[model samples]
Target chain A: MTIKENIFENLRLELRRGCLTLAVLAQLRQEHYGYTLRKALAERGLEIDESTLYPLLRRLEAQGLLSSEWREEDKRNKRFYRLSGDGEGIFVQLLKEWRAINASIDNIL
Target chain B: MDLLDRYLQAVKKHLPWQRQDDIIAELKANLEAQLEDKEAALGHPLTAAEAEDWLKQLGHPIQVAARYQPQRSMIGPALFPFYLYVLKVAFLWATVIWTIVAVVQIAAQTPSELTVLAAVLRVPGMLMTTAAWVTLIFAIIEFVAARCPGKFPMLAPPAAHWTPGDLPPLGQQLSGGRKPRSFAHALTEVIFGFLFLVWWLLVPRHPYLLIGPGVLYWHASPFQLAPFSVLFYWWVVGVNVVQLAWRSADLIRGSWPRPRTAQTIVVSAIGLIPLGLLLSVPDHAYVLLRNPALDQARYSAALTSINLSIQWSAVILCAISVLELLWGIGRLSLDRYRKHAAAMR
Candidate 1:
């Protein structure tokens, strides 16, 4: 890649990094398995790679921000996820912070 | 289904053993789900090439598995800056000390080419040993820090006490006080300084390097450097040690900071002291013992010519040293004035 494109890719990744976490947390408010959650987000135009999404779900569950359980779905065992009580609280605060940032950026622009 | 199983098995290899089965099961479900969805859209089973293409888009299995593993570093980001700083300072000091020792050895006696080569070869081994020790120490620090975060004040973040006032002054940032030396300039100095050091060490064993074909004439005749000039040779080597060390440090640091620029003036001034002593050795005193191995008159004539050249060379060197000192002082003064002006602004 050209240097400019490489720089843009790096910056784009950085910009998306925090937002990706917020989006995942927001999406996990209702129960959804890994594959369905990814598909749900992709259908809404936020296309995350399966590799990135699966690991992130585990990390969030580990951090007590999300809860998970293995259940048979459509004749296959799939790990389902949803925001925990702590996750719900955190997600609400994060959504507030996100909206504040968006409003500030809009004002600045 | 076979291709999908192979991919999940490949990913399973790279995952942590405890989580391998659990992670692979989930991943397998996800991939099969994706394949099913793709088949549903096309209303047909995927061919082998179609399956391969889908797996390729997901990336290599190792890459896919790697994301599942926790990120690890020998020296994590928190301690990395200190680790690097320690290594640089340690290497710089080591290089400086080594150069000093090498100069002293050469001054004491001219070493053979093989001996010089052996000494040169030892340097890489010394640097590697130093690096290994430094890295091991930092790795231990990283281990400790990982287990007990904020235990070491050095590694702890200054979050609680930090304020806007801790920021650097606007003027200092804008002016960029004492700009770093260019890599090109430092590299050139290092290359030439190293070459000069090698040449200087070689000169004693092979006088021909200095005087060229004139060494043959001097050898055939009986004129050699006077006793004082012989001592002066060692003195010159000693003075050059300081220059070599300073330049080497500058090359390593990629900057001539205030202390180094000050050392430059001091070194140049010290250099002139020897040249003054050299000038005091009397004009005819540069060459001693004129034995007539060839033609007596011709040898004497050549001796007188060589002696005059030596005297003139000393004078020229003395002038150059003085100019170097003056230039250093001027540059230092200008740097200070610029800094002062920037601060005031």
Candidate 2:
């Protein structure tokens, strides 16, 4: 990509950051393993690139914003994450603000 | 072997250390189960590419890992204090300005000359108009403040809550986007800073500067009018200085992790410059000229210039103050929304 195009792409990337949190919070209501979660988000019309999402999950988990566990059965295993108490509380608030802002935008538009 | 390792690594990259280990173990078990299931379904062993394709179809590893995390709010608990401070400042300023206006109107009129009832009625009307204007301005500020990036917490309520099955892994959720600072904040500081500096410089000196020619040519007329000029200059200077200092301190405190007491002292000290200037200047000065009596025309002309200057300063200061106050209110509202959002999750 040209340098100017790369700069614009980066700028656009930054603008979309807020929505990623909202999209992630919305999908994590169920206990899905990592690969499953990505598929779910993609299905829902939000496609998060893997390179970015992997680091984010670790960071969120580290911040005490998420919980996870491994399940083993029939000689097979997969890891799963679930919303922590704090995470759940935060998710609800963000949803409200999003809705409010969305409504305001809708009205304006 | 290559496919299995690649798949495992991809999934591992997304998981936390403890979670990663757990997930790897679980996936190993689950893949074994799936292999057994495939053996039964296909009536034969599955190919390595088919297994890799199955895992790829399921989605990226990070996306699946994120699903286990709790939903996070758009707004969080971190910004509550800042919000409350803005709210209090807006309320106090609005209350004080209207209250003074109300009391002055009531005090200036004589009970015998004017009915107390009429004066009482006017106060509420004035207050209503003042409040309406304040609310209207604050609403706009609140709307603008919400769009401000990085001024609020990362998590808040209604936005955070998502179903476990639907949620992306924490890594996936955090991976995108950056927000930039708002222009309104910068504009406010610049406008206020300029007004404050100008107001500070225009303050008439205490013994008063001799206008027209000095003693060498035309008799140096040291124009000394009512002590009001000194008081007026000092008053404007004092208000501007206090406001400037207050705003500067707020900006500094907001940006830096400094002690609140130190910030307050610095702000107050900056405000005291104008007050000191007012106090040190002589209240009255002799009109050192050929004619000792005041020239009403010339005196009025001087008074007019001073009055015009003071009026312009007041207008600028008032405009900036009102805008600042509204911006403060907007900041509070945005904070409240964030807290509410965080709480909802």
Candidate 3:
């Protein structure tokens, strides 16, 4: 890639990284397994891949923001995930901050 | 082997050993489910080609495995700057230690061009080796920290606790954080040496270059440069050229050199050879200036005293070079054995 394109791609990723975490937490309020969650997020126009989603889920679980358990369904064991109580609190706080920023940007633009 | 099983096996190898079975189970379930969905979309069981395409879309085995492996590194993003800082400190110390070793090894013997040349050539390789070892050590430390950060007090501190007091004092910032430093005094030597070279080379051809009209005094008549004196003059130019190149490099870099003692001591040591050669004049050495303004007999007598004074100055210079060489050796030897000495004490 040209230097300019490389720079913008990196900045775009940085801008979206925080938003992606917030969106992931919000979706996890109701239980969803990894594949179905990815599809659900993709359906809502925020298409996260399996590699990124799986790791994010693991990290959030480790951070006590999400809890997961393996369950058998359709003759296969799948890890189901949902937001923890702490995750709900953080998601609400993040949503408020995101809306404030969005309103500020809306005013300026 | 079944393609799906083989693919899962490859991915499994790269995952953390303790967590491998569980992770693989989850991954296997995910992949098989994905494959079943693909076959359902096509309204048939998957062909080998369809399964291969599906596996390829997941990602390369290593890339997929790496994401599941705790997102850790031999050197992680949080500790990377500190690792670089450690490497920088190691590099500085190594450069200094090696340069001293080179100077002492060069000086405590008959100074030769080849020895000095070898010393200069050895530096870049030694520096690179220092850097490599420093990186390896930091990487190992990083690995340990990732596994058990509580083991080392230095690496265990939480990021939130960091304050300005925890930061080190700013060191000599230069062109490159890793290297590239120059010294002002060294730069002065380069400029002075270059100008001196211009004058030294020019003066023999045109006596008026430096002294100008002062040459007209004593009814001056030029003498032929002696064969031995030619060697001495050439040696002087060679020494000056070395100084110019060496110091100019330091100047361009904008920071002082390592083992500064080496630069001073080696320059003094190499210089003594030509001075000794010049002082060992075989016959009447004052013929360079005829001095017709004085009576012929008295002029010869005065020239004798002048040559004697030159010899005295050469002796003094020889003494200084010997002392400087000895001083450099003493420091280098002391430094080499300092750890041993402290333990003995």
Question: RMSDs, each prediction?
Answer: 5.5, 21.6, 12.2
lDDT of 3 by residue, B1-345 (tens): 289899989999998898889878887887777777778889998888877887888889999889876655677777678777767667655654564465446545434556656776887898899888877877887778777857776754246367879875565333223353345556566556655655565555556665689778623443333467668877887776666655655544444555545666677777887987877777637244444455556555666666677678878888888888888777756655764676699
Q: In candidate 1 chain A, where is summed lDDT lowest over 10 consecutive residues?
A: A26-35
Chain A TM-score vs. truth, each candidate: 0.97, 0.83, 0.97
The lDDT of each candidate is: 0.81, 0.55, 0.73
Runs of candidate 1 with Cα error greater than 4 angstroms are A1-10, B74-91, B105-109, B112-143, B157-195, B246-286, B290-345
Task: List TM-scores of chain B, every candidate.
Answer: 0.67, 0.31, 0.51
Model 3, C-alpha of B4: deviation from truth (Å): 2.3
Question: How much DockQ does model 1 earn?
Answer: 0.77
Candidates ranked by lDDT, best first? 1, 3, 2
TM-score of each: 0.75, 0.30, 0.61
Better of 2 and 3 by lDDT: 3
Ranking by DockQ: 1, 3, 2
Docking class of 1: medium
Q: Which stretches of candidate 3 lie over 4 Å from their true place?
A: B82-90, B140-345
Best by TM-score: 1
lDDT of 2 by residue, B25-143 (tens): 65554455545656799887668777767777757776665554444333234334444454555544544454334334533443221333454456566656665665555444444
Global lDDT of model 1? 0.81
Name the TM-score of candidate 3. 0.61
